[model samples]
Target: MLFNSSGFLFLYLPFVLAGYALLARVRPRWATGWLALVSLFFYGYWNVRYLPLLMASILFNYWVAGRMLAAVAARRRRWLVFALAANLALLGYYKYANFFIGSVNALTGAHLQAWEVLLPIGISFFTFTQIAFLVDCYRGLAGEYRLVHYTLFVSYFPHLIAGPVLHHKEMMPQFERPPGLNAADMAVGLSIFVVGLAKKVLLADPLSTLAGPVFAVDAHPQLVEAWIGALAYAFQLYFDFSGYSDMAIGLSRLFGVKLPLNFNSPYQAANIAEFWRRWHMTLSRFLRDYLYVPLGGNRHGRYRNLMLTMLLGGLWHGAGWSFVVWGGLHGVYLVMHHGWGALAGQGPPRCWGRMLTFFAVLAAWVVFRAPDLSTAGDILHAMVGGNGVALPHGLEAYASYFPVGCSFEGIRWIDFSGVAMPALLLAMVLAFAAPNTQQIFRHYAPCIEQLLGTPSCLLWSWCPHSYWGLAFSMLFLACVFSMNRVSEFLYFQF
Candidate 1:
């Protein structure tokens, strides 16, 4: 069930929260068990067929981790390798088998029929979380394991769908703590969730109206249209993914658990490295710890390891060459940033760096968002004015604003509705100027990073006051009103 759906918002969450609250007072273990069952039900609500697959995965990993913890040093290393390989093998078969088959078929002229495999929801996330646990067990970093706690760690609904991927050391202890409802946490979480709901319903969904048609065009879009579409998508994806992350964190907070921050105003990042540091941060951490460090990281050399890490990281997003190219572009951007820093002894000026980084990220997003390589190339070509530029029909009165001798003929603006352009601009302004959800809720320590820093005066802040409560209530009601056409979160596909 989608987090945005009424069934989830009204029925599922309320029932689970009520039950857990009641159980927490009498039996905390039963409360934890109740949460685990509820989480499993949540996952199964997406597809009953995959429920067994998820259960098997959890059981397998738990057993493997137990073995890894008890083994001798050399045996532990072997067990860790075995467990990692088993997880990767499952992920690979479900996520990559068809892509690999298609590639081989194209190259070798073999008619290898790809198997019809259904990827279980959140396979990548749960698999990686388990892998991290096994590695930690091998290294003696993880504490004692309990089947119930481990299951809860893997199946917790908030981070289960799309994650700020949990680490065992960070999450398991929370499951062991006494569970109870906190009015303060509930208020703050609801406020943060309302903010996220507004982002998705009011901002991200509307922006898709501007982006969808442009990207869907069979022919190349006009220069202005291409840019509008590209920028619209850039903002659409930003708010969509960031909005989901906010909701996830907020939901976890309602359970009195703190999830790591996944997004941090990445559009404002001054460099590609900084962008990576902010965007999908847990994924970056996973790549750095599990993949890059194991592959020798920067210790051996910066360039090769960085490129390989990003290349695999890109493929991890989806089974598409476009994603590979997107990852490669970011990899190139990072390498160039490193080279420039080495020669100049410092990075570019903040303003210049921010602009450059945003543009580079925007360009890579074209590939990421496109259906295929050809469409990406066409959009990129149009973005460079390969197709002529023109103002829309209503803007003809501004012809005098153009350079002398310049003709407006043949250049055409996209025939957007009255609200599209304004909405797009508004979304952009908010993206660049507004404080993120974490920033607004900084006082509550809604995310891990907030634990160390003082709250800043910015666009807005959540406070335990009547005005803030009324504002959030209005936002939540607005989101509820817009829920007629329920849409899945964009990250759900990944």
Candidate 2:
């Protein structure tokens, strides 16, 4: 169920929260069990058929971790390897089986019909979360194991659908604490949720309107149309993903649990490396800790490790060649950034660095957002003025702005239909000028503050005051009104 949907926002959340609160007071163990049951219900709301698969995964992983913990040093490695392979095998079959078959068919000209394997939602996230837990078991990082706490950790609804990718150490301990409702946490959490709701409903959804037509056009887009589409998508993805992250953190906060921060104004980063450090940070951490470190990381030299890690990271997003190219583009950018640093013995100026990084990211997103490589190439070609510029018929009066006598064969200057210039402008201002949800809520300690560090005292601080409460109420109402055209969160497809 979408967090923004009426059933989830009004019905499911209210019922679960009230039940948990009442149960925790009298029977704490029952409350924990209640949470696990409700979380499973939440998952099953998407597909009843997959509910058993999810439960089986949790049970299997819990048993594997227990065995790994009990085994001696000599046998533990074998157990860990086996557990990792099992997790990967499950993920591969569900997520990539058809992708692999299609690729093989194309290469060998075989008539191998692909199987209709349904990928369980969040399979990538849960599998990786379990794999990390198994590794921690081998490394002696994880402590005592309990079935109830382990079940809650893996199945918690907020981060389960899409995640900041929880670690066993970060979450299992929280399940042991007595659950209760905190007024302060509720206020802050609700405000953050409203902000995220505004972003998704108010910003991201509208931006999709502008982006959709451009990407879907059968004919080549004009130069202006191509840019509008690209920029619209860039902002669309930023707000969509960031909004989901905020809502996840806020929902966890409602349960008195703090999820790790996932986004940190990545668009403002001055370099590709810095951008990765800020964007989907938990995934970056996962890759670094589990994948990169085991592959020798920078110990084998910087360039080779960086490229390999990014290539694998890209493939992790989806089973598409476009995603691989998208990842490879970032890898190449990082390599150049490092090489330039080595040659110049200094960093690029801040303003210039940020501009370059933003544009590079913007360009790379074309590949990420495209359905296929051909579509990606068409958009890129138009972006470079291959289709020439032409104003829409009604706005042909402005043709004087272009170079003298530079008329195209058929097209006008640029077609601006379906483009919401005002909304696009507003999105840009918010992205570049405004503080993100994290920065706004930095002082709340709503989640785990230590990992995010202390907020800068100099920036504006917004505590949970009456005025802020009123402001958030209005925002919440606005979001409610927009719910008539409710849409699914973009990350759900992945």
Candidate 3:
């Protein structure tokens, strides 16, 4: 279920939270079972029939890995490989089969028709998590497995949908015990969730409104329009994906589990390497440890390893050539950044490097966002100085980016005279410059404590501002919750 949806906010989350907290006090083990069952219901909320498939996957891997860990025979290692391959085989059949079949059909001019296949929800996430579990089992690192803990690890609803990709080691301990809810953690979690909700509902959705029309139009416009469209999309995508990550982190915290932070203001990076370090950090780390290292990483000649790692990393996103191109572009950026740094014996000027890298990354995002390679090429062709059409008449015709009839101003009678331009300008500035709500509030704690003249002992020992912040945070969250049609988290597809 979508975190932004009213059904999820009003119905599912409330019901689950109430049940969980109630059960936690009386029966902790039962609480975990309730969670696992509820999590299944949550996944089935999208498609009830798929619940069996997901459950079977969890059961299969759980049994196989348990056996692998318990077995001592030499052939047990080979059986573990078979089990891992079978799990991957299921994933490939569902996710990549059509992508491969279509490519093959086009290449050979054969009469092959693509099969209709529905990708299971959370398959990409759960599959990877289990694969890690299996590998840990093979290495004899996985401990005694409990069915409840395994189920919770695989199906915890917070990161289940789109993940920070939790490792088996990271989540098992939390499942093994329940901690009393800390008021301070709840306050911080609620605050983060509300801020993320605002980012998705208010900022990302409105930016998408600005982006959609320009991107949808087939014929190119002036260079100015092209740049505007691409820039709007870049901003929309970042806020949307990162906004979801924030909500996920917050929700995980509600259960007394700390999820790894996924983003760190990636736009502030001075180079492509720095950008990767900040953006989608968990995924980047996964690629570095699992795929890159397996392919020799930097231990082999630098350029070759970089290219191979990136190409595989690109393919890991999806079974598409465009994804490959996107990864390859970043690989090229990394290689260039490293070589330049080595030759100069120092990093480039921070500001200039950041600007250049930001634009280059932005340009690559066009390829990543496009529906297909041809569409990507069309957008890029327009972007790099394609002056395709002349405006119809006077400057008034194309004065606004929106079409004549469906413009936001045309549809709504909201006063444009007072706060519209100022709000837009403020939002744009805040998007680029202002510290995130998390950072700002962290700094505000000290000032708030001092302003209240609270005892130094009490103030330092506990979060003095939590109660006040919690109330305001809940109100803001309610506001976001009320806006039900906000778009799904952007990373859900990946």
Candidate 4:
């Protein structure tokens, strides 16, 4: 279930939180078990059939890890290898079977029929999590697995779908600790969730309104529309994915788990190399540890390492040529940036390099977002002065699908475009100029220290932290209003 939905926000969350908190003081073990059961229910709430798949995978991995750990025979390494392969085989069959078949059919002109396999939600995430666990077990890095902890690790609903990819070490301890409700921490969690909600529903969805029409043009429209769409999409994706990440982080925090931060305002990067370091950082980390480092990393030839790393990284996103090309393009950009930096003997300062890097990355996102090579070419052609026609008259038809107004005549003079402009500009400034809102608030560490230190504030149970109280109330109201129009999270398909 979506984190921002009404059923989740009002019904599921409140009921679950109350149930969990109520059980925590009296029965901590039962509380965790209940959480796992609730999480399973949450998963089943989406599609009941998929629930068995999730449980089977979890149970399979748990058994495999235990078997691999208990093995004493020298030849039994093969069993561990077999188990790892089986886990990967499950992932490969379910996620990549059709993709592989389609590729084979396309390349060889063999009339191979692609199998219709329905991808289970969060399969990619759970697959990776389990694979990592099995690898750790074989390596003797993890201790004996417990059923309760293993179940909780796999089924925790907060980061279940799109993830920061929790490691066993990160999650196990939290399950060991009591899952009590801390009012101070709970308030912080709710605030972050609301902010994330606003980022997705309010800002990201409206930006899509502008972005959708421009991209719908088969040929590019005016340079104005082209830039608007490209820039708008760049921001739209930032807020959308980052919004989901924020919600994931926030939700995890409520349960007293600290997920790794996903986005660091990647648009602020001074170079493509830096951009990758900032964007979808967990995925980058996964590639570095699991893929890039294993593929000889930069320890070998610098250029080869960069290319291979990016190529595999691209392939990891999907089994498509476009994704491969997108990865290759970034790979090339990084190589060029590195070569240039070496020649100059230093990197550019944050401001100048960041703007150039933002534009370079923005240009590349056009390729990433385009449907295929031809569409990407068309977009690039338009960007470089391909004389395309004006946008069609009914371009604003879908604008009314959102809460935003369509035309100036039926609505107030302020159009949807006008309404979103201020938010758009604010997002741009935040993307470029400031540290993220979190880092900015973190600057107030000393004031927070003094307030808690004060004699008068301690006695009252109802006293709220001023900044959090103000910010989250505004965010909560905004998210409530924003969700009145439904918008899909950008990463849902992936």
Candidate 5:
């Protein structure tokens, strides 16, 4: 049921879109119901066992929200607290129970058996989405909604699996409007989707191959290997997650809905703070508003709160100490950025800021991609030439940084030596230079709203002309031809 799979691309999507177009004009409710059922089907197709869990979650939250919407202030607080607790308890048990048990077993010599519970797909996303709804309800922000409309919003296929963490206020009204098949919307959505699919199929997937071997559990890659692998993975994730977001937004647009902008050109960010603003932006905003603000964000002990938020945010990504370290590194980066800003009036020069911020991010991503803390340390050590400097090819530009006596003649741990370097460099160029999906379709307001102020003129814009159509059609063909081995999006694991 991967979005890239032919089954989804050809069969499931076509059928769903056709049905919605047929019903939406006169029977918008039916169309909404149709989408809800299809979304559920899409989820269940991955794992039937989790279908009930998802249903139960939706029903409970809907009921709790309804109760909150009707209750007195005191009762509403109780219901909101109860709802938050229930949602978090479910997420914790499924996502963190094993991590907790393992930590306990390691620390105190307790042989606590790990629970065999399988983590449900998109548990973190759906749970957080509902948690936001509950909090808004408590804040008297979330208004009442029919059960059917709520169901569709929660289960909508485009943002269901991986998300921009849709807010009730943002999405509920869209569902209230009659769903229709607009040709203009379809053309724009399809163009955006084709570009996204090309990004994943042509760029992200192949880059994964370049990165995979270097991060093997036993492979202790050297300086050149490490940098190439690290850059490959960094760019890989950039395209993979952003590509998925583009596809999600475009698909939703086909239904005459625009999902919030999730991934802008984060690599273009000149500082860690700017990076957070651009990367997984909804999640960062969630951490800011829901977690940080509630925790007295920048009001009392700003640095302390920032660190705690990042540590928790890192752990939120996965059940690993490496993830914690990843979060912690960013936390430190932010703290330093803030501290420096206080001493000086502003950040470093723009060029210097971009370079420093990139390597800083590159270092953190090493930890994020590692199998464990030990492996992460090993990779970082190699990255700095700790494990003897050697060169398979003449790839080193910073060779003077190495010990003077170290000989670097011939060592080749890297595969596809000739192809790898060029591919990686080209990928970096694309990541740093290419116009993102939003910019490409900016003429049409490709997202829920344009988060970016103006589209960069680095690339051509999407237009209603046949040339645009033909170009997108060619891109579509390229993606389709290249989808020999369909792979799950990297964010799907989260």
Candidate 6:
């Protein structure tokens, strides 16, 4: 069930939270078991058919960890390899089977029938979490925990779908601790949740309308059309994914679990490297420590390692060539960033870096959002003025001086009279200038703080006084009004 849905926000969540809170106070062991069960139920709420698959995955990983821990040196390595292969094989079959079959059919005239393998929600996240767990176990960095704790760590409802990608060491200990509801934490959690819900319903979904028309264009868009669509999508993705991350953090906090920070203000980042550090942070950490480090990292050919990690990372997102191109472009951006740093001996000015980084990301988002290479090329061509510029009919005299393709009343999709451009401008301001959810809630230490480092950009802090309470009350009311059209978080596809 989507966190934004009324069923979850109203009925399921209240019942589960109340039960968990009471159980934690009375029977600690039962609290843990109860949470694990409800978490499983939450996953099942999406698709009951996949419940067994999730359980099987949990059981398999737990057993693999056990076997790996019990073995000798070579045996442990062997078990680790076996477990990794098994986990990957399952993921590949489910996530990539159709793509593989389709590609083969296109290339060699082979009519390979694609199998009907429905990908389980959060498969990528849970698989990666378990893989990291098994690797840490092999390296003696992680300890074996009880089955219930392991189950909860994997199945926890907050980060289960679109995730911050929980680490075992970060989560398991919390489940092992005695459960008691904290009033301060609960308040912080509700406030964060309300803010996130507002973002998703109010900003992200509406912007999707602008982005939708632009992407739906059958051919190259006009210059203005391209920018409108691109900018609209850039912010739509920012709020959609960012909103989900905030809700995840807030929901986990309600259970007294502080999930690692996921969505910082990535757009404010002055460089591509800094962007990665800010966006989808736990996934970046996993890729760095698990994939990049294992592939020789910078100890060998740094550029080559970057390409490989990003390529695989892109593939991990989906089974499509568009994703590969998106990943490949980021790989190039990182190489240029590092290459520039090495030669210049210092970074670019903050303003220059921030603008350049944003444009670079904007270009990459076109590819990421496109259905294929052809569509991406069309959009990029238009973005570079291959299509022409569109101006209002009254500006004909001014348009004649341009010495380029200029047309009046060329737009057929974007509606400026509506909330399109206004909302986009608002989003741009909020993204670049505003403090993020973590910053606004920094005073409460609502999320894991050390990873985000010191709060260097706090415009304001949250206060628990009546003024703030009334403001949040109106914000919450606005959130409820916007919830009339509930939608799924964008990251769920990954």
TM-scores, each model vs. reference: 0.93, 0.93, 0.86, 0.87, 0.93, 0.94
- Candidate 4 least-lDDT 10 residues: 405-414
Q: Candidate 6, after superposition: displacement of residue 297 in Å?
A: 1.2
Number of the candidate with higher TM-score, 5 or 6: 6
How would you encode candidate 3's per-residue C-alpha lDDT over 261-307 as one tens digit per residue? 78787877888899999887877877776667767787887777788
Identify the leading candidate in terms of lDDT: 6
Assess candidate 4 and give its lDDT: 0.74
Instruction: Give the runs in model 5 whose Cα sits over 4 Å from its true position.
Output: 393-412, 417-421, 444-465
Global Cα RMSD, each model: 4.6, 4.8, 5.6, 6.3, 4.9, 4.8
Per-residue CA lDDT of model 5 for 1-494, tens digit only, reads: 98888998999999999999988877767988888899999999999999999999999999999889899998998998888889889999999999999999999999999999888899999999989889999999989898888888888898888897988888999898988987557766777787778778888888887788878887888887788789999988998888889899889988989899998888888999999999999999899989999989988989999999999999989998888999999999999999999999799998899889999999999999999888888889999987666665564665787667455675555666454556667778877888777885665532312212233311222332325545666688888888899899888878
Every candidate's lDDT:
0.83, 0.82, 0.73, 0.74, 0.84, 0.86
Minimum summed lDDT over a 10-residue window in model 5 is located at 451-460
- Model 4, span 60-157: residue lDDT tens: 88887878788875734776688778877887887789888988998999989888888777877777777777767777888875698889888888
lDDT of 2 by residue, 237-271 (tens): 88988999999888888778888999998988988
Model 6 clash tally, residue pairs: 0
In model 1, pairs of residues that clash are none
Residue pairs in clash, model 5: none
lDDT for model 6, please: 0.86
Indicate whether candidate 1 or candidate 6 has the larger TM-score: 6
- How many residue pairs clash (N, CA or C atoms closer than 3 angstroms) in each of the candidate models, in the order given? 0, 6, 0, 0, 0, 0
- The digit string of per-residue lDDT tens for model 6 on 1-494 reads 88888899889999998999888878878998998999999999889999999999999999999988888778899999899999999999999999999999989999998898888999999999999999999998888899999999999999999898989989988888889777557767878887888788888988998888778748568888888899999999999999888888888888888999998899999999999999899999999999999999989989999999999998898899989989999999999999989999878999999999999999999999888878888889989888787765567768758666578865876877876678788889999999999897775543323213334212112432334555767787888877878788888889
Ranking by lDDT: 6, 5, 1, 2, 4, 3
lDDT of model number 5: 0.84
